[model samples]
Target: MTDDTIKEVLKRIPYGFYAITSRSGDDVNAMVANWVMQTSFSPRQVALGLEKVSYTYGLIEKGGVFAINIFLKDGADALKPFMKGRSKNPDKMKDIQYSEGPETGSPILESAAAYLECRVVRIVDTGGDHDTVIGGVVAAGVSSPGEVGDTLSLPDLGWSYAG
Candidate 1:
């Protein structure tokens, strides 16, 4: 298949947009991420495809924990500040309102409808630009009740991260 064809197919896969937060001691960060999904049910695990060189990746690596902040469709605007990488928006988390997750101590965005705290179980080198971080869910909370259909997604913001 051609590159354009591959891009088209990759972009066709649905993805949800989220603010992924990480912390290592005094350092903290939040970034926009779409490559997140649950990988297991028994132990409750989730995987995140994180750029190997990203600032958040370093924090997650050093701290061994992270949090996934899930927003509602109406909360799409809340994630805009994190759309930029740390190099372009170094202070993105400076003024953001958030609370520390009880288990991981990662930031949980105040505007999030729900949040999941996870502890790093493994970081796999996939021979790609991104590494797959497998985390076991340690804690979770729902500040605002909602169904899966009420969550915000990449398409809802007219953005694409695949292909």
Candidate 2:
């Protein structure tokens, strides 16, 4: 297969935008991610792919937990700040209203349409730019009723994280 074919094939896979949040000591951080999927059903596991070098990855490793916040399509603009590789501001959570999740103590954004608190089960080195972190869902909640199917997807933001 050619390079174009590879890119096109990867791009064809559907993805939903999510905010992956982690905390270390008193510090917390959130990053925009699309490579998140449910890997198991019986134990309720989730796999999140994050760049190995990202600050959020370090936090997850150190904290042993994380929270995934799903946003609505209408709130796509609110997630732009998280897309940045690094923030000049010391407190990235300052601009947003969020509360610590009871399960993992990770910041759960109030703006999220739904949220899931997870405990890190294991980390798999993908031997690439990213690593797969498996998490066990401990807690989850939806902000409002009837918000299902209104989540922000990659196409909704005109963004592509695939090759």
lDDT winner: 1
Query: Clashes per prediction?
Result: 0, 0
Model 2 regions more than 4 Å off: 87-89
Q: TM-score for all predictions?
A: 0.97, 0.94
As for candidate 2, its clashing pairs are none
- Model 1 local distance difference test score: 0.95
Among all windows of 10 consecutive residues in model 1, the one with the lowest summed lDDT is 76-85
Could you give me the TM-score of model 1 versus the true structure?
0.97
Residue-level lDDT of model 1, residues 24-100, one tens digit each, is: 99889999999999999999999999999899999999999999999999998898899898998988988899999
Runs with alpha carbons beyond 4 Å of true place in candidate 1: none
Per-residue alpha-carbon lDDT of candidate 2 for residues 1-163, written as tens digits (9 for 90 to 100): 9999999999988899999989989989988999999999989999998899899989999999999999888878778778775545456677888999998899999888889999999999979899999999999988855444788899877889998
What TM-score should be assigned to candidate 2?
Answer: 0.94
